[model samples]
Target: MTEQRLAGKVAIVTGASRGIGRAIAERFGAEGARVVVNYIQGGEGAAAAGTAIEAAGGEALAVQADVSQSAEVRRLVRAALDRFGRVDILVNNAGVMVAKGVLETTEGDWDRTIDVNLKGAYLCSKEVAPVMIRQGAGRIINVSSNSGLYHPSAMRFTEYVVSKAGLNGLTKAMALAFGPQITVNAICPGWIRTDMVEEIDPETQQRILDETALRRWGTPGDIAAAALFLASADADFITGELLIVAGGRGMH
Candidate 1:
């Protein structure tokens, strides 16, 4: 029998009801990890994620918590510890985006975007860090975006770009603070075929495809695989890095 890479591990994935977060939760479970599928909404989808994990012979628990709130994030960590004894991985996948030009965006939209995309990661990481430090090991994988970096697409998304850019900074700061025991990293994915990205206009989508070296949209599974690698022992020495899983987008 082939041994699972994450056997006996515990992972907490926020905003895991759908999209990349859901994919990560399912993939982690299949690798033999006990998963905590966290969702701020989409309760049914979260439940389904847990169910699928269990169906795959892995342990799972679906918990509803908002990562942007400290109390809720603390609750999430507590629940995971209560159920599984220790946390092995934390994928801060909870994020939001408001597609508007800089001048067209509102303050409320900006706040919401930053709260979810950047603050959410901060709160979850803060809560989990103590547990991980006590255990002497852990992984924090931030689901960031290349739009947060030096990409042409960044021009149109002010709030989202700002939030994710902050997230990337947080990734590095957290990595510096949490090491050499805990590894914190970010995965910057390009246009993935999530419901969110599918909403893009056809013209823009085609333009993205043209710029992408792969000439196609990425899958949630692609991000999940990167998460798996970061969460595994193979990445023990790696931290404070931004991995561009964007099918080579922004390369040109």
Candidate 2:
């Protein structure tokens, strides 16, 4: 039998009920990590993910928490600690997007996007870092986006782009502050084929494929693989870096 890479590790994956977060949680569980599957509203999806993890030879705890709220974030981490004893990995994958241009975006839209995408990461890290620091080692992986970078595509969702840009900055700052014991990093995924992306028109999707060097849409599993690497010992020496798993999108 092949050896498991993350045996005995405990991972908390926020927004893990579906999409990229679910893929990452399942991947980590298959590698033998006890997973805390967090969801905002999809309890059924979270339960299914937990069941899938257990069937794959790892334990799982499905917890619902809105990462944007400090109280809920606290409850999420506390639940993980109470269930698993220690948290070795934190995947701050909970995020939201506001599909509006700058002029069309309201104050509420901006706040919701920034609070969940940027501040939620900050809050989760804040709550978990002490536990990790006390344990002597940990990994914090933020699921950012390539749209955070300077690109024409970012203009479509102005608030979301700003939130992701803030997240990238937070990734670097947290890495510097939590060094020597905990490693912090971010994954900047380009055009992954999630339900959200699948909703786009086929013509637009083909245009994206044409621009991508691989000429294909990246999958949630692709991002999951990157998260696994960042959470494993193989990434111990790597920190404060953005791993772009976008199938060479925007390389032209």
Estimate every model's Cα lDDT from 0 to 1.
Answer: 0.92, 0.92
TM-score each candidate.
0.98, 0.97
Per-residue lDDT of candidate 1, residues 52-135 (tens digit): 999999999999998888898889999999999999899999888777899999999999999999999999999999999999
> In candidate 1, which residue pairs clash?
none
Q: Which stretches of candidate 1 lie over 4 Å from their true place?
A: none
Q: Model 2, 62-112: lDDT tens per residue?
A: 999999999999999999999989999999998887666788999999999
Model 2 alpha-carbon drift over 4 Å, by segment: none
- Whole-model alpha-carbon lDDT for candidate 1: 0.92
How many clashes show up per model?
Answer: 0, 0
Ten contiguous residues with the weakest lDDT in model 2 = 195-204
Report the C-alpha displacement of residue 36, candidate 2, in angstroms: 0.3
